[model samples]
Target: MDGHHHTAHSVFPKVSTTGKKGKDQKSAKSAKKPRKAEVNYLPPYPTGENEESQEQERIQLLTEAPTNPNSNLTRDVVIRCLIVYLEESLDHVLKRYDDADEDSVSQDLTVQRMKIYSIKTNTSDCPDDVGIVVEGMKVLAALGNFPRACSMLLGLTYAVNVANPKELRYTFEVFQKFLLELDCSKLSPKVNSLKNKTASLGKWALAK
Candidate 1:
């Protein structure tokens, strides 16, 4: 009877030790498990307020242009936006002219005259291009008097030189055609004599 009791007691200690070992194994596994990482999510589209802010930034950049032509600040900003604004205004005015109830001969006259001089002309569309040469001259005319227009053209000529060779050459050709097409009669008295002399020289060159 004593030996049987002692055997039962020894069995209980072995069972308790096994249970403790199992608990330790579970605790170690819990410690080894990794925590999940947090994630950040972003919206796909810009809000209306964000768009307005960007537009304001563009307007401010254009209005307060820096004097330095080589300013790095202007590199990423497209100055063509200004040119586009000017072109669109020209398009609007030209559209008004087209919409006027004039004879087809009078209507077709401008396009025909431009077609004769344009390196690349578009005649098929509703508002077909008279080439950049004619379009630029029209813009100059729409801007009112001559001196301001000349300054604008000279500034653009300088600016165009900074572009790629293809753009530079195309713009130069447009200016060359424009100079050839310029009428001395439209010039203001302030610049008339000087511009007439310059026009004569240009005509001489174009004759070559």
Candidate 2:
């Protein structure tokens, strides 16, 4: 009985030692395990630096761009309005003349004529007023009013000479061509006589 008890006691010690060894090995493995890295999440949005860079790019693009078509269209509209105003004023003067209101016609004509001169002076870069004057002279000539037409033409000649001397030679040549093409027999007797005088004057003037 004593020998059997000793053998059982020795077996109990061996089982206890095996259990302690397994526990130590598990603790060592747990300690050696790698730690997981931490992660952060952010909402999608532009940062301050990114926003500033985008703003600068936009400003640079605007500054380097060409002039817009809308701006050019606005300028063209303004010019057209000025031309229409001038035409309406002249038309009013002509209407007064047709109504036989001599004094009123003369006043309106003088005012409108001065307005044309003002336009030419202010818009020296545009020669549109010269074309207007030429058209007015043609209308007067068609109405059998040679004297008034000639006066308008003379005024145009003077204005062109002073304001745009470089264009004067071409303008005079056009005027001469227009006169030569007219049928003299269709003109009133007074107009025919005046035409002969103008032809002589034009020849002399051009010769110089």
Q: How accurate is candidate 1 locally (lDDT)?
A: 0.32
lDDT of 2 by residue, 1-208 (tens): 1122223333433222233457787876675422222111111112332334545654553443244545434544543443353232222212223323435534444434311221222423432122122222222222122222323443343323223123232222222323433112355444455567768999999999
- TM-score versus the correct structure, for each prediction: 0.16, 0.19
Alpha carbon lDDT at 35, candidate 2: 28
lDDT of each: 0.32, 0.34
Please write out the lDDT profile of model 1 over residues 89-157, one tens digit for every residue: 222212223333345424454552111111112343323222222322332223222222323443333
Best by lDDT: 2
> Which regions of candidate 1 deviate over 4 angstroms?
1-49, 72-208
